[model samples]
Target: MGLSPVLWQFLVHWLHASALFPAEASGIAPYVDALYFFLVAMTIFGTTFVAILLLVFSVRYRREKNPVATQIEGSTLLEATWTIIPLAIFLVTFVWGALLYFRIYDPPTNAMNIYIVGKQWMWKAEHPGGQHEINALHVPTGKPIQLTMISQDVFHSFSIPDFRIKREVIPGRYSTVWFEATQVGTYHLFCTQYCGTQHSGMIGEVTVMTPGDYKKWLEQSNSGQSLAQNGERLFASMGCNSCHNGTAAARGPSLAGVYGSKLTLTDGRQILVDDAYLRNAILNPSEHVTAGFAPIMPTYQGQISEDGLIDLVEFIKNMQSNYRVQQTLVTATSGEAAPTTPSEGTTETVKP
Candidate 1:
């Protein structure tokens, strides 16, 4: 077989690759580029202005031209002008970066989630559909995708250069980052944090595919059960369904619609039901007990592994979506006010 001209060119570039910037494959890349360019332009302007000022002053106020030097006090207007101008510029950039950070951090309610476990030297990814990969992630383009990541041993960082998103993977805690891939291609994924002896080798690739192709891939790579399905089975085996199934007599609060909503704690503090909160609630139930619910649920601290905890979290996340859809349909059919009762028949303590 003969290699095509395009393939030969790609191979040549790969062999002679330099430190070139990766392509902007994510929706947030443009915003990141904007901030980067802003900094570069400011640096150039400040350097050029200072250099020109020095040159002009040296020539105009030369000792050969004028023997005497005139000393003038600084102008308050000039000082204020310089201070306020720099402060305003800093404020503008600060606000712009803050907005972008929030947009990247706050995953959409409907984003497809993938769990990631960062070990000492490798990245393990698990799709909600049960497909698993080592050091590689396959996601569909043009859709919001959230990664709930945790480290097994030391702290690690999940970095995708092309996506402009990086998050710390802390042990015993969950951190999340999200992005919508705008381009369909393969991009580099790396652990930017210094882990251990194999830190340099902790690298991977992120493959973004089209919607149709991604669906096909999922169907083909079916693991005989989805993550949520496995979670449901684990829930039953762990005796979680007895309380979380939304029964009136259950001890624990109903989990339906509780994934992202805020719940009033027993101490009257409202907290969002995110990954970290859920993980804590599972491993430490007495710490942040929900209002009107007794702290009777047993902790699953040493009993469950990190991967198992993630599976349970994924199951709860799916329940939230299902609950919302069911509520919407019920409201449409009844033509009355939305029911206060939870669809799962449980008197869960969640407020909306």
Candidate 2:
């Protein structure tokens, strides 16, 4: 049977106004509920006590009867009671909040990692398998998922109302958040940080699916091809190997094992060789010119689309472990001009 009219109306109102709506429940829901209840109790107790005391005092010390109120000495018992009660309440809150904080920060060992990049007004997410989504995130239900996020431009925030998680996506630094969905549905994603003029419009969705459905969706998302394979093809087609190959006396630095390693510049400076650095080396090589390297590397700023850069980065990352180019052999055999002496510059420059 359906709910009574009054009950239905109440339910509708509660769903509209309450944060306890079923769809909004996620990992942090229980702790959030606890805090909400605690605050409500505190509010009730404070208002009631203050109101009763005011009424009693007003009656007992009315100005018409006696304008000068009697000075009451403070009681040790009153001080002890207030101090002990608040200390006990604070201890309870601290324990509860600490447990939830640990749960939120420590992700499951088996959690699948996804990379998310926040730009001016959009979110670009990529699964390890190379499945990419813009302004949308997809994860299988009942499986833990971790998002490693960074912002390409100004500061942004990755927030999911349903999950009760909000994290800032800072530039040049990484932040992570994790969640395991209990239900299969689409949830809203919002940039809670005021990034720029378009911050309000930076919205997206998170789609949770059953395991079986997730597999099917993954297949569809990948279209039966691997991202690395696609990326390799793109790399070769774009003539990246001409300069980045091991054997080439190409004007550009060799990209072999460049991912996930430390790159030392011609100057004394060193920087981590990561996806962001690789992308920057491709799109804006002049930003951090290698110590011995000339600023001859051309920028691919508009030549490649955002997705193309992601593919390229993925390809380079995959090559991190298995890249086996013989630099000396390529330089010696290639008909392209080779450097004659150690003093001669050997870096190759590619025209965008």
Candidate 3:
């Protein structure tokens, strides 16, 4: 069956252009569509109205018809109508756009977090399941996913046009963006900021799949250690356990419950401890020292790689609630003995 005449006409007349070809797959897409179409319609109307008036006045007041040039002051009613109408339109779009902006920037509670590292020529994504991908992202449809992105070098922008979300990936600082996909499909992911020579090649796909399919894909990858587990390993190996593990001789504060908490710095300024704060604490310890703590931690700016730093951050995040380290002993299907972290309130038991 074909679409109804009215529906077909609406599609053809309103959305057949390039502005509407991209499907709305995220919560913010509809807002973008409305703002875009409203501007397009206004532009068309203004152009047509001005063109018609010019043509009519040129013929009506031509030198052959009216020899004397009539000079007159402008009409207050016409002037007020045009000025107030455009001002009102501008104000409405501005307010509407601001609301949509906040909706995209605010991360919802319980949203799955993903870390992204944008280098000179590629986009690297680190999932909590220890699955890492270069130039690609896999997410479950209909779930809100929050991305913490930072650049390894210059400024870069992570953008998904279909989702109508884009944010700057700044170097040495973290920026975040969030979106909830409504459809299951593959969409284009691009770096809108020009980094260097291979900027054009820094494009990839975001695959949105069903929850079941995403789970299957994670299992198939067989990543022995979760992101937090790997981070924990890195944490222990790097001697971070010496000071941050709640010891009397330790100089740094215990990071166990620091994530998402408001921290008071030595300078009397309070800051929220988020992904960016953690990253900075590791890379530049002197920047924001916690109150009552000496700045003894060495800066790891060039010593640690981006992936390693991400793992460290994840480990810190998981420490908030004694996060389980899911280590598969044998394949779940085969039922072999694999080492796994003890769940909260559960005793560790080993099978022969």
Candidate 4:
């Protein structure tokens, strides 16, 4: 049967233009939805056109009306018209998709950075101010938020359908996704990948607040130490300063101003130091050993948490010749984090 008005309505309704329409919370959502609708419209048009031609040919070539079958010559012009039109349409679609992809993946230089770690059955979010949340992420509206995520266990997908953003969080690697919230409301966050038995329960909420409210929340939710501070503490506690001290006696490469610097590996490969490179160097040191140093740095594969690794990365990125490690009581015991109180004990400072 030919596609009727009822079929057209069904196609449109099934795509969730009504109750199931996703909220356009981020700046990229409207454009994403527009592209999706254009694709759906094209699909519907192609189906309708094919159905009409089928019905037309069936009625016109009926045996009762023409007794004998006749062969028709193929028209080069008709063939060329169909081929070139579909080719042009496909090229346009590809260009549109590629542009949107770049827009979604490239974060602005000043975007707010937030670190996310996913493990079996739960998600942990850490802010630069040291604020930590188990299942909820709070961000300010009208500001670009960039999330650097990693999976502590199996692979997981961090998804926020309202923002039209999703990225796969892989173990031993970092994944980044950014979005600028345009609305002040709460949206759903989910792990779209199945990890274990409790995968379904690995869900959370993302709260988008006004800039002022977000500032107030940040002030109130202070974790007593900034991420950089924690990184500084961890830096000394882990004895990282012994090798990365930037001194003549140091055995390993100095990390001062090395975050974005180009360095050559022992194997004659050159690489630019970035977040991923830092992470890999920390967890898998032998892979990117510096040209003049031995690969004696032990891998911190299971010794450090993802959040702590992020802290170390931040510290290294901002490290200068004058930077020093701020040793607190927490550095005394690397096994656990000591309580931060009104009376912060004596701190020891060591230069890089």
Say which candidate scores most in lDDT. 4
After aligning candidate 4 to the native by TM-score, how far in Å is the CA of 27 from where it should be? Answer: 0.8
The digit string of per-residue lDDT tens for model 2 on 20-119 reads 5635446565556556556666667778888999999789889988878778799899999989987887898788778878888888879887889899
Clashes per model (N, Cα, C within 3 A): 1, 11, 1, 0
Name the regions of candidate 2 deviating beyond 4 angstroms. 1-22, 60-68, 223-321, 325-352
User: Which candidate wins on TM-score?
Assistant: 4
lDDT of 4 by residue, 1-352 (tens): 2557788557556655575777888999978986897787778878998999999989998999989998778989999999998898789889999999999999998999999999998889988888989989999999999999999889999999999999999998999999999999999999999888999999999999999999998899898887877897788779787666564455556688898889998899999998899988999998888888777889998899888898999888777553333333344645556423212321323212
Give lDDT for model 3: 0.80
Model 4 stretches with alpha carbons more than 4 Å out: 1-17, 325-352
Q: What's the residue-level lDDT of 171 in candidate 1?
A: 95
Q: Which lDDT value does model 1 have at 275? A: 80
Give per-residue CA lDDT, model 3, range 1-352, as digits (tens): 1456787458645653655577788877877877776677678778988999999999999999999998887899999998999899889889987887777789899799999999989999989889989999998988899999889889999999889889999987889999999889999999999888999999999998899998898888657778877787677668675556443345567787799999999999999998878988999899999998888788888988878888999989878642222223213433545323223212312211
**In candidate 2, where is summed lDDT lowest over 10 consecutive residues?**
321-330
Cα-based TM-score, every candidate? 0.81, 0.64, 0.84, 0.86
The pairs that clash in candidate 3 are 329-338
